[model samples]
Target chain A: MSLETGTGAASDPAAAPEEAAEADSLGDLSEFDVSSLAYGAVGTTVFLALWQAAALAVGRTYLLPSPIEVATAFVVELTAPTTFTVPFVGASLPATRLTANLLQSLLHYLPGLVVGSVLGIALGVGMGWSGRLDDALTPVTRFLRPIPPLAWIVFAIVWIGIGHGGAAFIVGIGAFWINFYNAYAGVEGVSTHLREVAASLGVDDDLTMIRKVVLPAATPSIATGIRTSIGQCWMIVVAAELFGAPGVGFQIINAAQNLATDVSVAYMAVISLVFLVSDGAFRRVERRVLAWRD
Target chain B: MAGLSEPSASEPRSDDAKVVVDGVGKVYESERQRVRALSGVDFTVDDGEFVCLVGPSGCGKTTLFRTIAGLEAATDGEIRLDGDPVTGPGTDRGMVFQEYGLFPWRTVRENVAFGLEEQGVPEPERSSRVGEMLGLVGLAEFADAYPKELSGGMKQRVGIARALAVDPEILLADEPFGSVDAQTRDMLHEELLRIWSETEKTVLFVTHDVEEAVKLSDRVVVMAADPGRVSEIVDVDLDRPRERTEPAFADYVDRIRTLIGE
Candidate 1:
């Protein structure tokens, strides 16, 4: 198992000598061998230094803001209050700019991700497991799948109006296709041998066999789809907000338009930070769910 | 080596026969071709008897096994279990696979309890039976471990335990020890013999290995390829804990090897 190999590599006495030899050969690089965390710190420092040098060369804050300028703008966005009007109730609430934008983004993102994933997985499994359903849906899905989620922006605006609902519709469309294909492929690719085994074991009906055998076998693949959608829906979140929705994407576009480029960069960093945190959280859950794999 | 014995003649159905495979044949047909996998295959596995179907690749041993298990339909003839025709897979027959087909997601204990759960055996009985099966296979310690955590031998033991947990009349093992190492295979052979004696369940084991069939089976049904059919039925007239080094054991192996033209 990976646990054994992982621990073996970490504790191997032979590895230490080779690592020491490599460190000695590198001179100044030996100091960086403290840990992966130290290496990450060093890498970030080098990246910031390069960015600072490039920003100095450009000498235009509007064109390319220095890391310090973006940091200042990030602090300002975090500390400053923005008025958020509670929809359907005219009460106004004060939240930091970062918090307000994040909440606004989540207003569409969470619902879109949940609703789209549920429907997509249900339909995908249905189509995959039933030959009749597959035959019926294949042509329609083939036609619809080629059209991009962004292409539906016109419909979203016309039908749902320019708000959270429209943004959610777009994000939902993106999530739907990713999950659909994955669930479909997962169910389709379930081992015939396993089905036969289930049959011999007195799991007579398809539904019982699917619940006991097919679903568990296909879980790894389905999990892959869900994990992919978690990160992918974030991209969709930004794109959905770009068209007159009040979120981090809107802030980025608005700041860029006003030539407050440092504010735009800060908002972009917020999106990255949010995505990293969300992805990491989902990964932990996925690991626990799929612990059997290891 | 002992002289070749007379092939057993096809007799009328006896009351002792637990499984009756009468002229069972399977044909795989498509637009391009129709392949006769098994033709006029006949055999009888008596109650509490250990029978091994031995053949090479394309010999249709597995096809016959599947047809008997009711996992696949026979194009011709019928397989009767306790005088009833097998229309589909039922709880009466428990099958173990060469691949050690334990669900990876389930613990070893859970895998053994699957058939019992399907049979709707309640909580106390299911848990006890699962524990009993695990103990039978000497896997009591690894009960909570997943299939992936075990070796090939251990996995097949779990498969065997799982198959036996339901307390089926017959255990259908499809080359279960075929993938394990030789040393482990020997140990498993002894374990299987002990389990067979303890449970008194009729066994229909399939294997390509002539020695494995000779080692485990009370009767080895030799099969031939190019439209597979039973070539001979060799009764292993030997004592329990039969030694591989024995001349009679080697003779049985050699005779069966010759019958399969291998």
Candidate 2:
């Protein structure tokens, strides 16, 4: 297995140009062996065409706005400015609707994601490593895991009020459970053979064994959990903002209420674009850190 | 069984013996069933002696090896090293596994340096010792390479280097060459013999292959299944680099094979 991966890694540089040449061959449109990017492009074009035809058939922009109308709304949202006041200093500033909304959403997302992920990983690794802790907490976690993040909105509203803090609490709940389960499973799946090897190598105590052997062994699994949460928290972000949080999700709901369906679609696309950027960045970091796996 | 030597279970421990397995036994008990894997297994490995435990699949040779290594506890008796009881695993006995248990995330140098690092051997000394071990294993050129970039033979070489890095008194190898091909296995046998002679460390090797047992050890401890026990211990009085094609070598292999009912 190691030899096979070594040869594959060695040949990757030579394989890249051939794959690029295959992808660049636009003349063979009927061929089924194009690159995945080309296939994605073809699929997206077909989807847009189908969507345009459906919009024309409906003949109602208020219900299902056409792609062109949504594009126009996206441009307007990107360019139009809204007044924003800086807290404590009481300075008013003008910022674009897209920029202000994105900033507001990030204010709720970043802190919640960071704090929740840390706490989740700590508790997960603790429970997974110690059988006593796992036995003590398993029943409570099993009961709480089934409840949705949105169900905690009532507590969020009562405790933190209807703002970024409240929205962040909901997003944090989602992030916590996703990361908690992944880290727990990852640690549990660590190989017994590796632990024995560590033991024979002079690692006598549980703490030293866990620090040197278990953590590195379980890193790939923990990384997968974090990556999943990176995208999953975005979903929670939109659901979190549905009440009264001043973010892109809030704009989506507010525009839909005013019969501006195109604006709602525009905000939805913004969420997707942010998710794609964050997910892609995280994947690059994952690949670099887990380069040994290949 | 006719040509085989007497069972060494009755032999008392000598003063020069580095490891003594005194009536050691292991039983695995669960809710469903209780399995006696080893029963009153006894052996002694002298200082700097190379010994091999060979048996059938269910003979508990591995269980015995792991018990001696202190990775598992004996059910009835105890294992002593240098006149001291082995309560658990320690740096004094380094282990080489069949699966080449090198840390996949670490480079060859890091893997070799692991034991020394745990021993708190500081920087320059640790680096130099790791370099020496890698050179001894003929893997100095691949020191910076990860385990995934190496072949099976090379990985096992790293495993050996890692085991030897801590300067352990005993080297416990559990089928270290079992995963490699025949040619690689032969080469590793020569390498292991050279290392044993150079380091003067007592080696307790376990394998199911009769030929491997004959080729590597100063004595072969033949084991039987159905509650594993020592069938016989055969002393090989051959010289260094013994010829496998010789009649005496084949005689020992055949005698051990028959003793195991193969």
Candidate 3:
């Protein structure tokens, strides 16, 4: 999801209070399963029917790939032997729609994510724990924070070429700041009383205190950073592909450039699927990690 | 000044007495002002003695404890643990904070073992000692549980267990039961007394609660807060399992409160 869509999706339950004062806050929206299901079913049907009717009126399959045509394209992609050439790894092996493309994206995304998160957490926590260091670093971070991740595309390309290196660099840049801010906030937000308690316990050394007390207390915020980075990494994957990498982003860009609208939409769907499935999986992991929070 | 003995570290003492604070005073100086937190505070405790420093807020009861624990420097007095000056905090001085400052990420067992581990105790002995302390604090079931999962009282139990695991010569508790509710505080008081009886560690507990001091302490030292001076020292002499509603309890609490006011 784009940032706005992610935010909007987040705000649906949050904004119901504004939409209707009398709405049931506690009552489940899915309480009446039949009605809710029917509402969704009817909405989908009406939307597709209207879209089909509009396509027919336009009388051009190229301009408005019919829903049926798009479905056929999706099936074709599902059955097709999706293969690509890698400079280092010979001809890519045959794999399923779920495995080949998805795993390829993960191969690139995971390394960048791990590296970026580790660095960000270390830097953020370091600055947060020390007054002198934080003061020295604030101006530099502030100066760099406003420059968008895409703005770093030129540097990323120069530093790491146009393959996994470049894409990972771009993805890392996208994810780094979110975690940096979150980890910084986490350390700064630790309760003073808690620090005093640690001091009284004879664990007054800075590193020991942070590792033992501050980090645990600030976990909820750190989890937020991780979640935010997950979303950003997915976004940058697409952007990275646009810059000539072998992820879904590159697939989408390649299809769009060729004016293969059906293929473009199919790749878009793939991107959405990757984001949704990965987000859900990460959410499960995050809940388990922060089980101590609540 | 009648019952208050003058500064005399050279005075004869039995082998049973373990800690002596003679002519101790604390002066905090800043760019704008100077505050003398304590003055000529002389006290001594026998091993296994339960002494409570009772006072109003900011009375420096906490400062006195910190000084005794070697966590703070006393400007003009000497604190001797078994006739040795307190240079710094050591394994012998175990401290329990009111906030139940057990490491949130650590299991109860790990937190209890922190002090022993710091002292470089071997793993087998550390684990056994930690187990023993957890049992002493009635937290054996919570050995694997994290502090966040435990209630306020249970967290304090972990804190108590952590201090006890070190096998300290003395336990310095700064309002250790202040954060818990009345019922839990009462329960913990009983638990603490039992632990104190069993382990025989000298305890210097500081609290603003008059009745708590009277309930747990063998002697209650009340202090007044403005510049923080010792007001009076009352010998509780009440038996174990103190009766809060008893006339003597009420009388002691009222007397201490009034002394603090004056």
Clashes of each: 0, 0, 1
Q: Which ranges in model 1 have alpha carbons more than 4 Å from their true place?
A: A1-34, A86-93, B1-16
Predicted model with the maximum DockQ: 2
Per-candidate TM equals 0.92, 0.91, 0.82
lDDT (10s digit) by residue, model 1, range A148-200: 88789999999999788999898888889999999999999998988887887
Q: Ten consecutive residues with minimal summed lDDT in candidate 2 chain A?
A: A23-32
lDDT per residue for candidate 1 within B108-168, as digits (tens), equals 9998988899889999989998989989999999999988899999999999998888888
Q: Which whole-number lDDT from 0 to 100 does residue A58 have in model 3?
A: 82
In terms of TM-score, which candidate is stronger, 2 or 3? 2
Which portions of model 2 miss their true places by more than 4 Å? A1-34, A83-94, B1-13
* Fnat for the candidates in order: 0.83, 0.83, 0.24
**Candidate 1: deviation at residue B192, Å?**
0.2
Clashing pairs in 3: A241-A250
Chain B TM-score, model 1, reads: 0.94
Each candidate's DockQ:
0.73, 0.79, 0.22
Best by lDDT: 2
Q: Global lDDT of each model?
A: 0.87, 0.88, 0.79
Clashing pairs in 1: none
